[model samples]
Target: MNVKGIHHLSAMTGGITVNYQFYTEVLGMRLIKKTVNQDDTSVYHLFYGDERGNAGTELTFFDFPGIRQNQKGVSSISGTSLHVRNDAALAYWIERFTEHDVTHSPVIPYAGRNVIFFEDPEGQELALVSDETNSGVPGGTPWEHSPVPAQYGIIGLGPVKLTVRKPESTLAALRLMGFTEKSRIPALVAGQEDIIIMQVAEGGSGGEVQVEPRDDLAIARLGKGGVHHVAFRIEDEEELLAWIEVLNREGLQNSGFVDRYYFRSLYFREPNGILFELATDGPGFDTDEPFETLGESLALPRFLEHQRESIEDHLRPLVTKRD
Candidate 1:
């Protein structure tokens, strides 16, 4: 089965309010869903994306207040790259970042594309890549209330960078899951080895994954402001289950099949220890609420409905900042 592209990338956050403010007010993404982690309902599971909360556009956060800062090193998803329209869009983001006092690096070239590196309030690494030639997936809609104009708004997720102790075993696992090695690029960061770019069928922004060898670094500890898992898009349940079969056949352990309400998911860690997930794209954010009122209120899956009151009381109230 062909994995289409990125489904969504989920990360951990130290402060939900700060995360909400930066992603919504500063970055101009819509808070498309306000829900709690299904496995552990005390913490918030916030989903931010385009107006419709499309698959490739979603960037989710699991709020764990007062959690220890993640120790950055090998065996973790080090950064997430977002695609922009072109150089003009990159300039717009630079200006906006300056205006908001968000710390960011100067535009840098990697793999022949111009990119600006930055971090979220909680220190999750992020980048904006300019790819004028590539038009993203069809039917993506921009958030109406976004401060950034639609033309220059972030198109979707770009390649996710993973810091691994070694690339050989990880590359083998990725190939088993249908990723093809594209090219090897010089490391943009000091002290790191070369970067290997891989992609699914004819990859675009959300379809690419970068593997960076960082054997000298320490093993990463999962905590606040660290990536939990990188989810790649599958067409539907059929494709999702097929991947489970493939993983099992190859003797790789996976989460079997998990129904995440918005999407069905199967999760497993690559040989280097970076978590990966395969997620379906349908029954999306609009399942519980209409497109017009998405993210307007706290939403819970049917199983959690019984504890809605308790969950609401546990989570701090979040309000979107709109112009």
Candidate 2:
């Protein structure tokens, strides 16, 4: 199966405002869209990324207004590393974090790249890394609201980092999806050797890592403050279908195809228990809004038509026309 790259990453959160401030004001991503969660209208489904909010550029969050912040452990998502242009950008981000008083660790190497690690207000881990490997595919077409200049904006998502209870089951599923053993590194923090790294050879999206849980033996499971799923990108429907066949042969559960407005998605779970999605790149974010205004307002795929009004009501106003 020919998998293009990462599509988008989704995580759960506690509030809409904190997400808006962290993703935009702190990280400098453009607030491309302000919409509500299609599944639950009361919460917002916010997307922050480059001007165009391209596939890999996306970091989406679902806000559950009063939910308690969840623990970050073996069964939770570890972190997401975003690819940037160089150390200059990385340094700029370090200073940016300092200016906001957001605590973060110094740069460290992992999977053959230098990365700056930090946490969102709700404790979701995120990283910014220089594109030293130059592996990311070209970012999608430009959009107006992006904060970084179009050229230096993200090319695509570097690999995602996942921590699971047992690595074997997830490793089996990743192999079936064509991910290969890249290398094994010492745990990024310290006093740990339970880390394993994997890469998608054909993917232009960057790299992904899966780690063994620090204290137990089970797949990382999703919950209130956990990552909802990780989406991998494919060139088109045919390539997507081929992978569906590979997944079935491996006995993994997969939902054939579902239209998600801009792109068609195939959903499944990896062996270590993380939700995985395979999404097509077409009918992209540019489909609903013109390339000129891709992230300007609420955009609901046709399937969620009836809930639009309520979705709008619950979201705290973000990038307004004036700003």
The number of the candidate with the highest TM-score is 1
lDDT against the true structure, per candidate, is 0.85, 0.69
Return model 1's CA RMSD, one decimal. Answer: 1.7
What C-alpha lDDT does candidate 2 achieve relative to the native structure? Answer: 0.69
What tens digits encode model 2's per-residue C-alpha lDDT throughout 1-323? Answer: 64555678888887677777777666667666666676677777877767667677777888776776665566445678777776676777677678898879888775677778888887777777777665545554333445655544554566687777667877777776667776777765666555777667454335465555454433344444568888877778787778778778878788987777677788997765678888887766666667556556777877776867866776667553424
Backbone collisions counted per model:
0, 5
Put down candidate 1 lDDT per residue, 1-323, tens digits, no spaces. 87787888999998888998898888888889989999999999999998888999999999898999988999989989888878888888899999999989988887768899998887888999888665434325678768889988876788898889889888897888789988998886688778999888568677788889976889999888899999988889988888989999989999999999989999999898888899999889999988888887888998799998889888877775333
Query: What's every prediction's RMSD, in angstroms?
Result: 1.7, 2.9
Candidate 2 positional error at 29, Å: 1.2
Residue 45, model 1: lDDT of 94
lDDT of 1 at 172: 90
